[model samples]
Target chain A: MSGYHIAIVGATGAVGSKMMEMLEEATFPIESVTLLASKRSAGKVKNFKGMELVIEETTPDSFEGIDIALFSAGGGISKQFAPEAVKRGAVVIDNTSAYRMDLNVPLVVPEVNEEALRTHQGIIANPNCSTIQMMVALEPIRKKYGLKRIIVSTYQAVSGAGISAIKEMEDQAQHMLNKEGYEANILPCSGDQKHFPIAFNALPQIDVFSDAGYTYEEWKMMNETKKIMADETIKVAATCVRIPVVSGHSESIYFEVEDELATVFGIQQELMIAPGVVLQDDPDTQTYPTPLTAVGKKETFVGRIRKDLDEDKGFHMWVVSDNLLKGAAWNSIQIAESLHKLDLVKI
Target chain B: MSGYHIAIVGATGAVGSKMMEMLEEATFPIESVTLLASKRSAGKVKNFKGMELVIEETTPDSFEGIDIALFSAGGGISKQFAPEAVKRGAVVIDNTSAYRMDLNVPLVVPEVNEEALRTHQGIIANPNCSTIQMMVALEPIRKKYGLKRIIVSTYQAVSGAGISAIKEMEDQAQHMLNKEGYEANILPCSGDQKHFPIAFNALPQIDVFSDAGYTYEEWKMMNETKKIMADETIKVAATCVRIPVVSGHSESIYFEVEDELATVFGIQQELMIAPGVVLQDDPDTQTYPTPLTAVGKKETFVGRIRKDLDEDKGFHMWVVSDNLLKGAAWNSIQIAESLHKLDLVKI
Candidate 1:
């Protein structure tokens, strides 16, 4: 039973559970797995790969003998515990925005930027869920055609917020359908001053709006995309929105490539064979990606590729993937696998 | 009651009923009102301003003495009866996409380009539900700063399909909540070969995709925006998606203005006083518009205004309005009112 010893912080949360499932399904050669949570959830028992594991309360000393720690509790928790884990010589792969923008912490979407993990200084930040899928979809095209600009509008799922938010959306919809007025306390970013019902509506604000007007979630997509791609020259603008979806996050992207002769066919061909990309575009057959269909998948589904009628260098497509899997859990696991493959992880 | 006679085509449909309500609410100057529908719907009685009007089977002679005819049945109905209504001395303001691109037809969003009504040759076409609202928000800015490019992504409602489609969405949600599998008949587009469930899901394809890989609905937005604004030079691109909402259509628009000095505050100031525009964008108070709040509203709600960090000329905004109202019914009625103001209606 010789394998890497892994500690999963926030193991009782929605994404944390998914991370456990992904690790077990992918068979990451774990010698021992530790389930860690906050004080309230510490004594809870959860099942993983047909075995029950008791959740332990996280402390700075929790990472004493750990080889790797996966963090997904929240940005606040990640900020507080990530450095502590790193101080104990454990590599931290954080799924929060806590250290994503830090110059020292490598933001890695393994499909797109696995090479960045080699430069990681004990902590490797996982990009935002929306940015991870988009990066995987665009990386192949960028490698061949040269990326220039991107203008995207996202239809994100409520699950991106957490387990409680998903329940809130379900309860709100049920209440509205039963002719009872609904209560809202945790949507359109719970940390924001306002809470709106996302039962059957679209909220343009994802995270709290900064003084400059862009929500912090929108800012994450714009900035994280640049850092992950390592190309600040490429222009990016995003309008992140929350729709009444439970799992998959879909995006409508209009991007321009540097190649003057890039055709829609060429783009489709690239996506057809790109790693972790499933091209489901066939309008005549009524094929395209929807949130419902992409719910359990770990791949970024791209479709509806069309050349812009006015702008020669522009093209439009739809991208969708499971927000918890490819967006958070599986992505974190992929980064770990990449590190192991590159011999960067110390056990 | 010494005013012109008016006829309502497709009077039994959703947009058509809304037209009747708008007409009655506005107290349009009318000597008499006639309701016309297909042969199957004929003989049905509907109330208008406390008067029962029997729907007559639409025919070439139905508009014999009518001064104004409002059409909203379907494109086939509009294509078949628009010329007949015009030949019978009635001015037709169609809510269908039949003749929107026709050189002789003036595609109008009354609040944006009412003057285009002056050049109408017996028929005026209403733009798509998504485009009309975007136009109302962008026109004021376009007039003040000059628009160069627009990239929009739409979250259109099920009602935009018709009354039946709205019911279908409701039924799907109900069945899903009850843990029963449901069937989809009239979503994405009724004419499209396949149908997908819209319950808690977003459909990327709105109308049928054209040969060029864009949906007819998406094409309508791109082309109709240019025609409604009378500026083909202002480039446009759209990705039209149908969401499960029952009423309002929401859009996320990113546009570049010709004036490099335009600020977000200046744009908000112009929208505050612009006709048919309601500025609901106080981020501090969390006062943006949602589909539930925009339902039954006639004015276009604009908010979430912000400047792009890297592109100085670029700005982002969210627009929402009842698809059946400002997008169709109200817009058609407004066109007729404009025609009456200019003394362009003939009987």
Candidate 2:
């Protein structure tokens, strides 16, 4: 696995930058790291291990000698370039919706569906940001309790929308303080027909509404939950919301298990032993996971666990994680690590 | 009903100031107005109707000549002063939680349960802010479709905590921007042992946690829904979160109806025609109700209407309203109007 060549598509984007940072932190043995982005971002130099690597223009030939290609570009770019990379014998890990939900490609969350990586035809799809953190937090619970139903409402950060949305929030907040009007152009979806300012606001629509009346974000949660848990029988409902927070994604989850009644303390203890999960529940001391505190941290923090008043079999919890780390970059790298450990990716 | 003498208890508080502003806007005739606060605020003067009203200490004798009294102070203050006002023959619309669940006292939302005002025994209780907005949004649907279950996740503003909490959010944001450390003394719950900064964060605990592990705010929503709707069969669950926003409260509500096969457009139309509800859903134009736009608005904004994917009998909607307006002060005044129209208030 030593001296493997890697190509990072969308090297100038938010998730791409974080992926680079995580790769550096993980100290993956890299013979050469090729940074690739659009022509506009070409020639931009990003430092890795005290060496400056100039970002090159992304094209079909970018993965000529690359052993692994990580794609955080938009869906169109992935759809066009992923096959090119795979044709050049480089396994592609796509961070867009282009390959997700496709019958051939595996949508992998390392802790929950690491085995899925072994069966990937060419590209492995990363689940939605909100879905990634949630799956990691709930997988252990599901394993222990035999899950039945899940209801989740997400308090998502602005960074999930990309760097432009973060700027929009800041500019809008300053404009509001100055008593000036600013246009909303980046969120709740950039490609959507219109935009709404997210500064000090919560937008219910994360992606376009699907045929079933659920937003694409909600549908992703529903579909990805079944896929990752490998249980079509589990009922899942999600309401995805964008909040003013900049980094972490927080969720209020209520679940009903098929097992006997589980105490809040028991669930907390189970979560503590779960991989990639940290239990932060302590009501008497006012300790709970929050976005500001979860920023820059890799672990998904769970807190505020309690039994549902009317249902002895149901329990509720609050989950928070850095959307950039555990939700996107770190999770993607974790998949790459799983691939290495399982001998699923060749160098 | 002409030239009635009115008094406002807790005149220095958040809801109290909004009440004063609403009284100025109401068409009801008033002969004189009195401002009453604790001994610390006794010497302060609040401007109302182009005249400064000196604040007086709230006591039993303070309600001697008052025709109508509005109480926005804490529950303790309401518990001590409301009976005194009633004993002095003054009708009181109390904004505290002291009597909301009492079988003897009527808990009212002017548009939803105004009929409850007819049976008030001198003192009327205002429902919780989050509950008030949700009921205003749901009552229309409940009346038209007959609601069965309500699951709500709230993105509540800091202002609902008080003026100080709002200031704390601003200070915290500024401190964060300037790289300064500041203590959180008001949020999550003021009475709770520890506090966490709410700037760029979401706190799942709105009020103190109860024996059942639900926060007081969530419990209030569950209990108040039953009391206000006068139906004990309606199943309700709530997750109350405090965001960095200043005023409006936004709720993601999933509700089940007794009838079958209702579309999102149908629910939107029903909400459009419902009293005190403004429909803001238009996916094509990305128009939806946000807390920033709901500030200072008297109506509850309903949008993001969609049917639940798995439930044919269920629908989801996003509801937003100014917590200080329809949630508290304006609702209080509306209750006064209802009482006056029903000839329930003795003047």
Task: Give me the candidate number with maximum TM-score.
Answer: 1
Report the lDDT tens digits of candidate 2 across residue range B191-225: 88878899878998898988666788999999999
Q: Pick the candidate with the highest DockQ.
A: 1
Cα lDDT of model 2 by residue, A1-347, tens digit:
46668889998888999999999877456788899999999999999878999999999988998888999989999999999999999989889888888989999988898888878887899988899988988888888887988888899999998998888887887676556888898888887887888887888889887765578899999998898888898888998999999899999988888888577777877899999999998777778899998999989999988887766688888999999898888888888777777877777
lDDT of 1 at B157: 89
Residue pairs with backbone atoms closer than 3 Å in model 2 (clashes):
none
lDDT digits (tens) for residues B1-347 of candidate 1: 37879999999999999999999866457888999999999999999989989999999999899999999999999999999989888899999989999999999887888888888889888888898999999999999999999999999988888999988888888888777999998888888779999998999988888868988988898888888888889899889998878889999999999998899999999999999999999888888889989999899999999998878899999999999999999988888888878888754
User: Which stretch of 10 consecutive residues in model 1 chain A shows the poorest summed lDDT?
Assistant: A24-33
Backbone clashes counted, model 1: 0
Per-residue C-alpha lDDT of model 1 across residues A1-347, encoded as one tens digit per residue: 36788899999888999999899876557888899999999889988878999999999999998988999999898989888998998999999989999999999998888998989899999999999999999999999899999989999999999999989988988898888999999988787777899998999888887758887888899999999999999898899999998899999998999999899999999998999999999999989999999998889999999998889999999999999999999999998888778888777
| Error at A245, model 2, angstroms | 0.7
For all predictions in the order shown, the interface RMSD in Å is 1.0, 1.5
Residue pairs in candidate 1 whose N, alpha carbon or C atoms collide under 3 angstroms: none
Candidate 1 chain B: worst-modelled 10 consecutive residues by lDDT: B24-33
Docking class of 1: medium
Give candidate 1's TM-score: 0.98
